[model samples]
Target: LPDVRSQDGFRASLDAIIIMRSNLYTVGRLIEAVMNDNEEEAMDCVKQGADCNQVNKHGAGAIHYVFTDLYLHPPLDLLSKMVANGADVNLRDYEGDTALNLAIKKTSLRPDNTMYKVVDQLMQWGADPTQKDLDGNDALALAENRKYLDIVKLLKKQKTSLIVPPPHETPVPSPRYQKSTTPYESRSPITHSPSPVHPDWGTPVLPAIRSSDPLIAPDREESITSAIEDDNTDELDALLNDPHANLNVPNSMGLFPLHVAILRNNPVSRNDMVQQLLNKGADINVKAIPNEDHDEGGNTPLHMSAARDQLDTVRILLTYDPAISPTNNEGLTPYNYAEQNGNSEMMRLLKEEQRNAERSNKSSTCVIL
Candidate 1:
């Protein structure tokens, strides 16, 4: 049978929503629709009485998932719909992060400025630029600290009167996404405040400060990507320990350290390095930029690993984001890459993981961009 998601039309998925037993499931489907930019389907769900403000198991709403893409820019109109339907523009997720905050973090990882407009829309809809999370860092502070100058500028333009109260005045409900059996601990030493920046370069998020002279070493010698390629656990450990080290920042090739490790193909230590990076806050679904070398520009670590036949690395990444079905620039998923490579084991593992994710619906599972 053809996958319901790949159908010419959206029959199967809509059917799943109709038969869903819980409001939570209905809300989850709404998020899925919004993520895929199916406005008609999403509006139908909303009109059917599914709350646009419903928080999925991940402790986030449709707005939080909208900008998660590293490629395939999301339409700002979708966000407008959620807000129009009374979704909270400033509701914080389990991480105490609002949609604007998440948008700022993700935009820095990619070259596209589409999210800037999304942030602007959110601001116009009353997403408070000065609203702080648990860490006392507001959206403006995060943008500046992360060196998102454009976002900083946009945020600066907004006034406090634009701050809208949450549409649902009730207290936030318990997370629909289950917690991991292992208590999660963040390895990043940097908390939520705006991080220190290099005077001339702005913040170093993904901004590579190249040295003009070969003799002079850049202030920072090792990057998360370099450490992964060298398999230098010691350097990787030291790098992650710094609060300001950007784990999700892509290098010149738009590959995160996790992607580099997958391509490096160090059979003995690559898997270990992958695990180490994830533990230290690496994004399991971080993707590479599109280029001729890849089937599509937006290949994630999973796609790279499957294409290169790194079985162990594939296994490790799945554990972090069991339901990750991210497609590349070509609109092919990691599962497609595995099948194309004729890797039966990779195909089986991804299929099994997809089934399990459907059964359990790890709503708490979030891949921080």
Candidate 2:
């Protein structure tokens, strides 16, 4: 150690340890380090007095930019470092959003993103879920609003301790918390299928199919359609598992069970049912031929989701078939349907998906070349 710490000696020592720049200690370098997943350099900057909670021009910090799903590696590793370095988990951005809020918003683009892991870590580190953004939406509200049920479920488990202070007003209960009053039959275990029986469709209708095969019960077709429309996954599962169940059989209007599932508003269960049908070999790009009721043909499940402004379902379908761009009888692709319905969100998502598909094709072509 120096014998006497004169002002000049102190200045020299400070300059050696810290890079005094125009922004004092540029937080942009910290963000760039995170973006590149350079943990060692990020820690070095933090050790030399880089603001872990520093906000950029967009009022976002290193934490806000760490939720992406585009990287080859999980961003959680870098995120863990940020939190470990004493980054404020609950530090609000200019929009009053914490790191968790940004994670919830980005889930729309990549529903299969690592948001679940990111959110869990945030909560475990005492990120306050009750903190509202400028739009007066908390992490729970953002999750519910965006129809990210998985996040909602995760947040609900931590609700008891998430509140920093007693909330000024009681929050509205999300639909997931509501109990269903409709009676449901217990499903058989996954290994076996239940005997085919007419399911309760609330109203009796003439049998839609007449087949000698025991699996294709006359009334079962109508019942299965009803089950899909009503978001009854248990019955839907039973019908789907049966080897003879016509997964692609369209109804009187030429709409398949998958189409009906996409149109329904129940996201969590509807998504599950869609996945079940897909797993059981439902066509990913099946279209609804025009009928008197719905004169629009060439409308696949993707189109239905876009028309209904079901972004969650849209994302799910897009992940499976990003190249889908079939036009309906009216010569409208799913993007057109979104535009026709004035759903800007759906329009943006569909266009972005199309762009992604185009980029992927170009990449494939380049590899072949």
Candidate 3:
């Protein structure tokens, strides 16, 4: 039948294969043991040829698991051991996130201030700061966005300075407006109105004839205006709906219904009232009724919204007409108002919208051409 020498050789070969498979299993168990925090067993397994750089199905190397999980805490001596034994420090996870980035994200909000240490360690170990996430945000940009001022400051200091050397001599542009040859002069002396005898009723007013032939006289002891004023939404609604209540009625200060609402400090109620009025077809672009005491500023709701930095209100008003610009008493537009208010976010949004509009105009022109 079979040759006796051939049978002996085949039996030896099978034994050798079994021993190799057993060694692989022992190596795998050692890695698992290390991950389980059994240091002695892990060392023995490592001695038996457990590859420290070996990754699981998810591409998470031994160091990745150590850094990302509770296998070992920082000071990272075990991590250093794995690294020294040939672990890939810069190995990426399934989402392409590096070990350092994941470490930072994990410890960013840690209560013990360990995040800074982790970040420092990463940086020292040559972690890339310029690497971008899926949203195109770099680490520095993300830190700034989340208001991590300290981290941002540190990162900025560590990075190469962006400052440029000033030119030796820069040319200045000539003034567009010509200077007046003659010295400026005051126009005229201002005259003051005669002082009133009584403070409450400053001046006597004549009864004016209405369209119904009724004379409207100033009433004595005008009701004290409360800061909360009145929530008289029902009355306002009725007046707004009424064909005869004169939607153009002005208060003593000559503030229109819309103007009064804008000037009020209570944003919540004022916004509600504004929305209600707008729902009843109130003119958002209505100019304030002019008064002798104060110029009504000719400010539309959009102008007021920008001045107050009410971004939501500004957005709503812009939806009606982004191009609408109500001039203030100083002849300043809403854009000017936004700049004066120091609303950088609002200013940026407005500028971006303006740029988009310009691009759209250019595209349309190209089509026409």
Cα lDDT tens digits for candidate 3, 258-343: 65565444457667766765665557777655444344457666666675556666666556544544576768677776776456
lDDT of 2 by residue, 102-136 (tens): 77777343333345666777788888888999999
For every candidate in turn, the CA RMSD to the true structure comes to 23.7, 15.8, 25.2
Task: Give the TM-score comparing model 1 with the true structure, all chains together.
Answer: 0.38
Q: List candidate 1 stretches off by more than 4 Å.
A: 1-222, 291-296, 361-369
Per-residue lDDT of 154-273 in model 1, one digit per residue for the tens?
A: 566464222334888853322212122332212111223443587898843322223342222222322566677777789878887887776676554445677767655346677788
Measured with C-alpha atoms, the lDDT of residue 106 in candidate 3 is 62
* TM-scores of the models, in the order given: 0.38, 0.40, 0.36
lDDT of each: 0.64, 0.67, 0.55
What pairs collide in candidate 2? none
Which model, 1 or 2, shows the larger lDDT?
2
Give every collision pair in model 1.
Answer: 57-176, 57-177, 177-364, 190-243, 290-297
